[model samples]
Target: MARMPSAERRRQLTEAAIRAMTRDGVPRTTTRSIAAEAGVSLSVFHYCFDSKQELLESVMTTITEHYVAVVRDAIRPRATVRETIRAGLQAYWDHVAAHPGEHMLTYELTQYALRQPGFGHLARRQYELYAEIYEALIEQLAAGMELDPSVKVPVLARYLAAMTDGLTLNFLVAGDAGAAADILDVIADHVADLFRADT
Candidate 1:
């Protein structure tokens, strides 16, 4: 193909890798397959990613960004904190519902990384990334709403991350959109209660 910036090329390859991995399990996806999926030469794939581990990291980060961006935009201050929180959670739930395969792929990636020798760090980093994103989102919501969280930001962030993680998996397994929506309402109410006026 015509020349493109390295960053752009990497993004193209990363998206292709996600498609390949999401379609074929992480264990089955190979760099060569990703190259083909990206419609790029093997050399180009190698030029973009040094190792499969690096590619996996990029894929994980990209996948998280996909949904986090939606939630970020959905979380703009609303009539009430509960509304804002519910909007964000609902945005995330919508993403999970629409892309259940992709969400399932994330869990598969975590398991694949953990079971692979010397790759455990990838799984840990995957989780740490989740908490980090939640922390940033929490801070954003607090600042936007001028609210103070009863729990520390980091603690609250991790709790939210864990709650969503479990809830997403539950939805995937149970395939119950109505039940998931009800749970999101509960989570939004619970999280909103954890905040108060900043003053």
Candidate 2:
């Protein structure tokens, strides 16, 4: 294989780990398997990740970034705040609808982390990343649209994160696309109502 920077090699292995974990539950995915998936030697995998915990954290962060990029692009100041919010939510929902397996793997990772000794912090970090992403998105939207929210940004961010997390899991379990879309609409309207454009 051609030589690559350490960061590039780590990203390659992380993506491979995501594929492996998503296919074979997190508990089942081993560093050897991730190495094989990435077409790299086990030594290289070890060189990149000190432990499974580090790899899992990287995988969770990458998975979140996948959909976050989509939502960020979709939220770019629409004609109205409601339209922008709905676009962002729809973008995220579309990702869940399309990649159910990947999203399911996120929940599995959470459970796997929580149950594993010395790995509980991974689960907390995963949720923290979710809230942090929402907080950044909220700030971005507020700044772009000159809107002030009734609720503080940090609180609203956590609320939105929790709401979106639950809603995604509900759709994953129930498999109701129509109902999910309706709920997204309601959420968009409710969220839009919470913000007022600066006069």
Candidate 3:
């Protein structure tokens, strides 16, 4: 068999690890299981990644990047800040509704990252990525609507990050999409009010 390039093999191992972790639970997943999932030898797994921890970090990155695309693509720019906020948030909720497993896996990995030694940084960086995505979305909305500079982009980004996290957890636990979405709609209005320069 022909040998796979480093990058391609790395991607394969990362994706295989994600599946193995998702199927077996992160704590129970083993390098052997991951190698089986990848159809690669144990040596290949070790060659592609230094350790299981490294492979898991890659899995976290992969999942994060996946949802970033989902959330970004769902949001539609609109005429007014209220419309924009509502559109973006509703689209976000819709994505969560459609991909509950993906969202659940992300939160699970976050908890795992938080508990592991030398891996807590992954959890922190996950939120940082969330904040960055939110900041970019806020800037995009600002192009069409005037934002209150005093409120600050980072502040609002963190606020949205927290709100979405809580709402997603709530929905996952209660399966109450209707209530969560309604509350999110209200939050969208309030957030728009806070940032709206016109009002």
TM-scores for every candidate against the unseen true structure? 0.96, 0.96, 0.86
Error of 3 at 162 (Å): 0.3
Which 10 consecutive positions of candidate 1 have the poorest summed lDDT?
143-152
Ranked candidates (lDDT, high to low): 1, 2, 3
In angstroms, the error of model 3 at 151 is 0.8
Model 2: per-residue Cα lDDT at residue 131: 91
Tell me how candidate 2 scores on lDDT. 0.90
On residues 1-199, what C-alpha lDDT tens digit does candidate 1 reach at each position? 7999999999999999999989998888898999999999999999999988899899999999999999999989888889989999999998998899899999999999999998899999999999999999998888745545356889888999999999999988989889888989999999898877655
Which portions of model 1 show Cα errors greater than 4 Å? Answer: 144-150
Query: Candidate 2, which segments miss by more than 4 Å at Cα?
Result: 144-150
- Residue-level lDDT of model 3, residues 83-138, one tens digit each, is 77887787788778887877787888899988988889888888898899899988
In candidate 1 the C-alpha lDDT for residue 4 amounts to 96
Candidate 2, residue 104: how far the Cα is off, in Å: 0.4
